[model samples]
Target: MEDKIKIHVLNTGYVEVDEALAFKDKSYNPIAYTGLFRSNKHKVKVPVFSYLIEHPKGNVLVDTGWSVASREDYKSHLPLKGYIASKPILPSGENIAEQLDKLGIDKLQFLILTHMHVDHVDGIRDVQDRAEFILVSRDELKAANKGGGRYIKELWKDTIFDRFDWNGEMGPYFKSYDVFRDGKINLIYLPGHTAGSTGVLIKNNGKFVLITGDAAYAHASWENLELPGIINDKVRTLRCLKWIQKLSKADNCVEILASHDPEVKPHIIEI
Candidate 1:
């Protein structure tokens, strides 16, 4: 029998942004997500998470957390506009490289990124040598390379990306990529958060765990069908949330984790 897959939920750092950015409401502010010119005084601090998947085939890491440089000077670490969008809070030993070192993860077979958001990809600099291949969705890479708004080209300029396409329909929107050509680990295209924002579906021993990387910000995101503040396509976001709602009800669904949920802590989930 194959060993159970162990998923380590690692919290690299935290980001403080406007509450609107995490969950959308009736507020009509167009640039609320940017944390600029918003009338609302509400700010929220949420943890940025990275996942280490111990699969039978190979070890995989999903997303890279904040870089250590941000801890010294966030202003210099990010562009002026990017700094205003989301302020990073990285303490000593909270970055991906330190966390990976503590976990004794010397190398990873694949580094699968859910999107190119600054918070998700900024830590790549720390782990570039640790991962053999870095993977991103084809559409995501295109959008990131275009360089506008939240996608900062500087963050991943030196990083070479291996693009993967969706070849089958297994999740919402009828788009999913079986990473290992097996049903155990799949990448579900949950766009709208970004051009190619993807979620992960991990199955082991007849159980499932879904990692919604900003596709839904928290359990309440799909529970109340509340869309995230920043959305490229409102229709697609809603569709993805609805599918998440349905899947959460399945008996085989062990847990659904959101990347920045304050309630989710660093833990090991074996499925």
Candidate 2:
């Protein structure tokens, strides 16, 4: 077997979202949290993270996090004519490229995007030319072109993606591709957060870590079974959540990290 891979959680930046956007049943709508009609002065800051995996075969990254330009002005990347999408907030130099540079890494063998959310793909331009290839699910490419507030394709329209495919079912939806042809790094399909939203399941040091990108707001949501406000399908999202919860209960799942969960700080897992 190949040597275990190391997983490093990189803090790219954060987003300031309406309380309703992260949690459901927390607003006047009853079935929702916050939106234009029930908008409130309250706000929640969620951290943005991208994972760096060190494998003997090659280096891999999951999600690009936020764009560097966002550090200057969070609203700069939004296409709403200055209206922010998720009201991203970041300090200067917290971008993915700089973070990767701090570790003395230059090229990425595989750049896996969890979904097309603005925060996840904004930094692609920074490493697009250097990375060997940007990989994303086939369904994600189609969903991004479907027109939505978060599916901003302009950031990475020029980059070619090697759409990773899998034909069997793993949990609630279509099966996942154990990228690398090993069980250590599996791209689990847990749709609903976005049409093609996916997460990474990594094995290291006899423990498995699931990096759930916006699948659940935080550990609390998954622990308490609370659904987030932003979703493509509530039913499917719930099923996905249950699927993850089931995995968490297993002895191998050491932890499940949420992309924007401030509670889960960045750390390195030795394998």
Most accurate candidate by lDDT: 1
All candidates' lDDT scores? 0.89, 0.79
Q: Model 1: residues >4 Å from true position, as ranges? A: 26-28, 38-41
Per-residue lDDT of 1-271 in model 1, one digit per residue for the tens?
5689999999989999888888888464667777777654677789999999999878899999899888888888888866687889898998999998998999898899999998999999889888888989999999988998788899887898889979879888888988888789999999999989999999888899999999999999999999888999999999999999999999999999999999999999997
Model 2: per-residue Cα lDDT over 52-171, one tens digit each: 998777889999877777666655566762224376666777788988888888988889999988888888888777689788888888888775657776777788999988754565
The 10 consecutive residues of candidate 2 with the worst lDDT sum are 28-37
The TM-scores of all predictions, comma-separated, are: 0.96, 0.91
lDDT assessment of candidate 2: 0.79
For candidate 2, the C-alpha RMSD (Å) to the true structure equals: 2.3
